[model samples]
Target: MRNLRYVLLAGLLGTALSAQADPVSYKLDPGHTMVLFSWSHFGFSHPVADIGITDGTLVFDEKNPSKASVEVTMPLSNLDTHVPALDKHLKEPDFFNADKYPTITFKSTGVKPLGGKKYKVMGDLTVHGVTKPVVLDATLNNVGPHPMTGQQAIGFNATGMIKRSDFGLGAYVPKVSDEIQINITTEGSVPKAGQQ
Candidate 1:
């Protein structure tokens, strides 16, 4: 009876440790994290813009992927469309109104893992002061030791769509194509001890 009790306690402790090992917190590498968006322009061309991440964190669990979470922020000030005039126009009140809402953010409400390395990440996206639910089809690219930093690293590629009008940024609407396609590539790593 005494040996059976000892075995049970050990089993419980082992199970707890295993569960705790599933989740890992990763600090997003700003230099490598970016969001790219493209929209059709008057049925003639598709123009793309790039936005770099300011700061973000991701909590991921490979064993139990549904337990994963993500939070990210990108500054509108970082938006660039490769066209000086358009860049300036996009920040004006007629568009993003960067002076008022300087940033765009997303916080995941839930993560649903699909077969293999794909997932549907549902989150609330805030842009131009309006918040709307968005879903990103995300794929885990890799998770292992970083080649450059030698630290544990993870990377993912995700794509989603949003309507500019829904966020109140509908300056041109149908002419500029209200729907925007967004592509995201992010890389994160476990921070080193004593590192910021």
Candidate 2:
């Protein structure tokens, strides 16, 4: 009976060790992260827009990247589309309604590894109180030590598209291209408390 008890204890310990072996954190270093969007215009010229991630957290266990998670928030009022009149329009109620929403957010639901260095990351994106599923085609750029701080870090590129109308962002419609393509690049590190 003692031998059987030992075996069971060993099995339980092994399970705990296996779970702890998984590395599961990615930090979004805002300095190196950016989000850009571009779309076609009224067949005359192409217009583009871009924003930066003010704050975010990216979590992952590279060995089992399918369990990864991500969260990001951006200031809608900081939108830069290269046109003042259009930017003003975007801030109004018909568009982002910046006065009410203020910020846009995203949180991951599922992560699927496609192959070596590639993945499909899906999440719920909330803008103007509307939550919609957004899929980002992700690529693991590299894993190494950050040159500046010599800290362990990883990089990734995520790109995807969503219809503007889906988020109640329909203002110009056919004239401004409902399809908005996005590209994101991010880097992260572990947190050190007592420091903001």
Top candidate by lDDT: 1
The collision pairs in model 1 are none
- lDDT to native, each model: 0.94, 0.85
TM-score of each: 0.94, 0.86
lDDT tens digits, residue span 136-182, model 2: 99999988677877777888999999998999887777987889889
Worst 10 residues of 2 by lDDT: 187-196
Q: Per-residue CA lDDT of candidate 1, range 9-91, in tens?
A: 99999999989888999999989998999999999999999997998999998889998999999999899999999999999
Question: What is the Cα root-mean-square deviation between model 2 and the actual structure?
Answer: 3.0
Model 2 bad stretches (over 4 Å): 1-18, 193-196
Candidate 2: lDDT over CA atoms? 0.85
Q: What C-alpha lDDT, on a 0 to 100 scale, does residue 76 get in candidate 1?
A: 90
Number of the top candidate by TM-score? 1
Candidate 1 Cα outliers beyond 4 Å, as residue runs? 1-8
- What TM-score does candidate 2 get on C-alpha atoms? 0.86
- Evaluated at residue 88, the lDDT of candidate 1 is 96
